[model samples]
Target: MAEKFLQAERYEAHRPHVRAVAYRMLGSLTEADDALQEAWLRASTTDIAEVRNIGGWLTTIVSRVCLNLLRARQARREDDIDGVPQTQGAATVVDPAAEAEMADEVGVALLVVMETLGPAERLTFVLHDLFAVSFDDIAVMLEKTPAAARQLASRARRRVRGTPPPTGHVRQSRKREVVDAFLAATRAGDFEALVALLHPDVVLTADPAVIPSPEPVVILGAHTVAKGAMAAIERAAATGVALLDGECGLLMAQGRGLRLILRFAVQEESGLITEVEVLAERETLAGVEVTAL
Candidate 1:
């Protein structure tokens, strides 16, 4: 009885911290409350003897629950696409005002951006970046290798740092050569080569669908964007250089299913990329038809 009392006290002390983790993992206050409640129940039932650091243990428990909820939500959305009737509250409509408030309160446009991330990407980013949780610990929760977990976080980071929309194409013929050289640099992980292709003050932006944060990740300057993209060598292997919406760029895919599009705004006279927008929202990704390379 005494031990149980101590455990309850400890759990209460950490409730706020636990709830904060849940709120970031899920944008909804109602959902965060639900996740915290579930975490409490699991913590209560867990063996007290096994937990050395109560706060860490509780955080792990709450994160795992949030991860499950995010995955289930994605699954439910997928099911709805197949005409399957979802459970009540499965497709719950978040009040637009409330959603806006949450986003503002968090000082991020995370509310809208979170919907764009895959489940694991969301969890990995939230736990590792926002909460300062270790990747090894995250890997255990995610059932992934630490390297794989790190890769997921890297992908999420790139998604957040979105590409700018391409506009004003001139000398479209030379676009392919520039893009091809860019990909070759990316594949080779050659930093100088990549930087040479970008305009001195280039801008990059991405849609919320690829980034879970409220504000889109935007990068400015040739050198900065180049160094960042150089690390994308592994992803380069999976990318196909092609033309999107009449501009030359890259098409990323998962097997035959197109998953992302990178549209470049080139400065024809200089033969440098002025803007690079990598978009992966469902509508944009789905309607993409590759132009002849």
Candidate 2:
């Protein structure tokens, strides 16, 4: 009984850091809390009598729990594509306002980029780069060699950092400007500005993964496209201008969950958007190259 009490006390002492690690790994506060509780459960049930490093042991336990959660999340996303319903885990009600604030506090861009990483890559990066966990420890957790773990972290770091902004290209810079203006208008809910940025015959195409239709949906004309864009004004705050496949595009996300990538085709003379492609299919999204502008 005394040993159990001592273990519980020690868990409490390390709760904050462990919870932070879980948050970085899972990118969701509700899920992070769940991971913490599960970690504590595992820790309490196990005997640690001869354990030399209690803190490291606790971190490993929490990280493993988080890694399992990340893997399960990936599986559920794949299942979603097959029309399989997924039930949520035991999670507390999340307030959008609070979540947004926390995202800001944690660097929203970083979290958004991290969402694109694979489960093991994300875990390795967060544990090593973010928390200073040694690669040796990460390797054991990931069942890989220390060198392999380092390689995973290296790849993740590159994706998170992204490529530098384009230079010496007037056309590319202009397209970026237009995208920036479009995003600004969307966030401000300015109908006229949105219409001005689009050509009269502008075409907006979306994959079925975006709208649940049997086939891809297409909308034409500036007014029609502007109205559709306005309808998604609420998403503006969560969207950002990014370079997709070396073209100006928008990456829309909600609380670290990427939803759609909007690729724009702009006419050089008119400087107006001619076509907009909305991609949400998992395969398409995975293949997209997102560079922070």
- Candidate 1 lDDT by residue in tens digits, 1-293: 98889889999999988888887788666678788878889888877787789889999999999999989988888878775545535433445455434544453323334457888998898888888989999999999999999999888766654443365444666787888898888878788988989999999877776556687678899998886565433456556665565566776543223557678888868989999886878777656544433
Backbone clashes in model 1, listed as residue pairs:
109-214, 110-214, 162-205, 162-206, 163-205, 163-206, 163-277, 164-205, 164-276
Q: What lDDT tens digits, residue by residue, belong to model 2 across residues 1-293?
A: 89999989988988988988998898888888888888998998888888888888999999999999889888888878866546676686777766665654565556777888899999999999889999999999999999999999999988987776567478888888998899888878888999999999999988898778999989999999988776543556556776677777787666566678888899999999999888888778768777644
The candidate 2 region of ten consecutive residues with least summed lDDT is 100-109
lDDT per model vs. reference? 0.73, 0.83
Q: Least accurate stretch of 10 residues (summed lDDT) in model 1? A: 103-112
Highest lDDT, which number? 2
State how far residue 279 of model 1 sits from its true place (Å).
20
In order, what is each prediction's RMSD in angstroms?
Answer: 13.9, 5.1
Query: Candidate 1 local accuracy as lDDT?
Result: 0.73
TM-score, candidate 2, is: 0.67
